[model samples]
Target: MPYFRPIALALCAFALAVPVAAQEVNVYSYREPALIQPLMDGFTEQTGIAVNVAFLNKGMIERLRAEGRRSPADLVFTTDISRLHSVVSAGLTQPVTEAKLTDNIPAAYRDPGNHWFGLTVRARVIYASKARVKKGGVTSYEDLADPKWQGRICTRSGTHSYMLALTAAYLHHHGEANTLNWLKAVKANLARKPQGNDRAQVKAIWAGECDISLGNTYYMGQMLADPEQQDWASSVSIEFPVFEGAGTHVNVSGMAMTKFAPNRAEALALMAYLAAPAAQEVYASDNYEYPIAPGTQADPLVQSWGSFEADPVNLSTIAELRSEALLLTELADFDG
Candidate 1:
């Protein structure tokens, strides 16, 4: 069994001493508590419903399954469409048709079945060397495979969720054959064998080992905030590359209600609160992710990066294609 480090919100501690049933909601989150502490704190402050979180580094689904109806979790928070979809597909989540959720999150960012709702969005963008690459040099996703970029690209493993999501989107747009060819071409263009996290690729760019890398947009904000990595971040510029006819590829950090939520009403309230404008603002300003709620703007720093239309394909569709994307990545020996 995987162990989860429990995190009790400071404001909720008073509930522990109360004799009567406590007004609280339990969360099983793959996301670090610090990243979401502000939103959770706000929810508790507004509703007086205590928030208790179990931070799980891995095995969220397995833990839920093992606990079954006895699971103390009311909600599950995670990033990536694949993970959110996996929970719903595993029968661990229930449909949430709250108008507050449906109205705030764009349809493309939510589950068609109402099983999950995205709180924030981040693009899979190109991090290009400011000195080495010309503006407008990298125009689209297809451009990455051009012979001109051979030995000039750096990226994490193709099997990583972020990469797979992009590949799955490619599959949606161009079908398997073209996606496989693109994968092979991009692999052939690697400066080194696929390695490291998205930020590591940026560090490689700063080292002059590569000219550009594929990475999520939030990583730029994360890098800039770190004193040591600021130089790596400064060496690169974020570019929103589009698909041939559509828009830039994106993924999300989202939430879902557990099937057997003990505090169903409170959980629903938290879910609605998370989707509302106030919580959306916290996601944007604090975590550096783009808020999903309509009319919410990203942090000023995030806004300075410029914007592009997010790919219109429903994220659930991309999630459904993740297996094929992974298979294609393996067949192409993308990490080799």
Candidate 2:
């Protein structure tokens, strides 16, 4: 992950010159433009308010923190619970006042101060080599730690935010010692040095470089849907493991309002709109994430993975445990 910088910028000349009350929203997002543009269009179409966006590759919380109150961003639409946690910890973001967000999003997936709210969920799932692993052989997150699976794993570095969120979840349920040991066991089983994103893991399995790897539910969706990745998708099988006594490891793409938002009401409206059923569904269908709002259902591709019990642990707890998770990751000794 890298930090984004503030390159002193002025708003549109007309926007800056216009009197207040024109109703506009400016969002800085890590989510891909194609995935969110439709929703932005919908918001503009329905509200008749213009929306400005800036697309980023994966990391901006740290950058926003550096920008401080000078940041022009009204809202930060991001993925990764750990990243959202970082933003809240820095006090660069604030809570939304809209009751709709509170009513629509669950407490577990949001911040206590309402500083951030999850828009969608992506499960940390297993993608097994269909030729090597049987359909019913693996069905839980705990299975990855078993001795029998030694030397069969392929994954990204544990230091990556993706795995840290999972490590945080394990710590939440099994405690540090047990989760630490499990991570060590998993480290010992690696077929190669950890490297690449979730999609690369699936590709590794396809190449017979490894039999299984950790994957995000959405990557599986794009792999299956994209003509270029269809071959990779075909070589693997998707699994949702409930982790023995704990819930499945899951993460999210979330939103938070900037502390110094120039348009506070517009920011709150954008956050509330994202939590609404229509926007939630758009996130689900477009990003293949499980909608954070209760009545919002997942996309068809996500539904095919089969349901499992999700870790009931509140994400704030995971945020609180980030340091511990980082330490455990270092202890695991991953580099790839």
Candidate 3:
């Protein structure tokens, strides 16, 4: 009897020492941690669901495929439509047909098949020198390829996803031959070889190395916030260039549920919450991005840039054309 009693007590102690797993959702993210932490904290506080994040700068799809069913990720978060499309194409994300997502996110911003949803949007705009380039000087994207602007433009590599997306949009508007010509013209106009990120182009404008460049709208906010970079930002103003008929090109930061999400219900809940006004507000104010949720306002700084018509071309159409866009860039040898 005494020996039996000791065994029972030991079992009780062991059970007490090993705590039960709490409700939580694991996230695989390409966005930086500091940018996502506040949203995660808000979700945790509101729903009592612990959120774990893994920030990956590259190879997100490969990592998920390698993990397979054992992947601990409940959701995948990424910037740029290119990456979101890659995740969907890789078959790693499950279709989510939640009304909250569908209702809040616009049709153009979410997958038609419900595979992913965009959280925020940013326009790929031109940055013209405030002093050197006159206001209304650049009204359309095609204007950048004009002979007058040759030897006065700066830009990042054409092979970059950002550039490819723009090229893809151009292809949709102007056909292959015209887009190729446009690409070659833009490349020929470069003050120097396409090198450096968007901000670096603005730095060149400040340095008088170039009078104009291409950059994203959100980066303008980032530059204005930095005292050292404010001069570069101040030297230029954003131009919402259109495709003759279509409006300005824009991209998104978005999310999706993993096909093997262990916490699907929690993941769905998180996804819905992110699409809600509260989370959209956090994304807008903190990230300086245009919220996708209808009626959700842009950050004050973003709003100050004034509104322009967004290109009405469906994002799926753009995604479908990305590969061809890359091929054209290579053919034009834009970077070379």
At residue 284, candidate 3 shows an lDDT of 67
Q: Evaluate model 3: give its lDDT.
A: 0.92
For this target, which candidate reaches the highest lDDT against the unseen true structure? Answer: 1
Worst lDDT 10-window in candidate 3:
278-287
lDDT of 1 at 258: 97
What TM-score would candidate 1 get against the native?
0.94
Error of 3 at 185 (Å): 1.1
Cα misplacement distance, residue 286 of candidate 1 (Å): 1.4
List TM-scores for all candidates, in order. 0.94, 0.90, 0.94
C-alpha positional error of residue 269 in candidate 3 after TM-score superposition, expressed in Å: 0.5
In candidate 1, stretches whose alpha carbon ends up further than 4 angstroms from where it belongs are 1-18
Q: For residues 104-216, could you state the per-residue lDDT of candidate 1 as single tens digits?
A: 99999899999999999999999999999987778799999999999999999999999999999999999999999999999989999999999999999999999999999
Residues 235-314 of candidate 3: C-alpha lDDT, one tens digit per residue: 99888888898799999999999989999999999999999977887886787889978788887779998788899887
Q: Write down the lDDT of every candidate, Cα atoms only.
A: 0.93, 0.83, 0.92
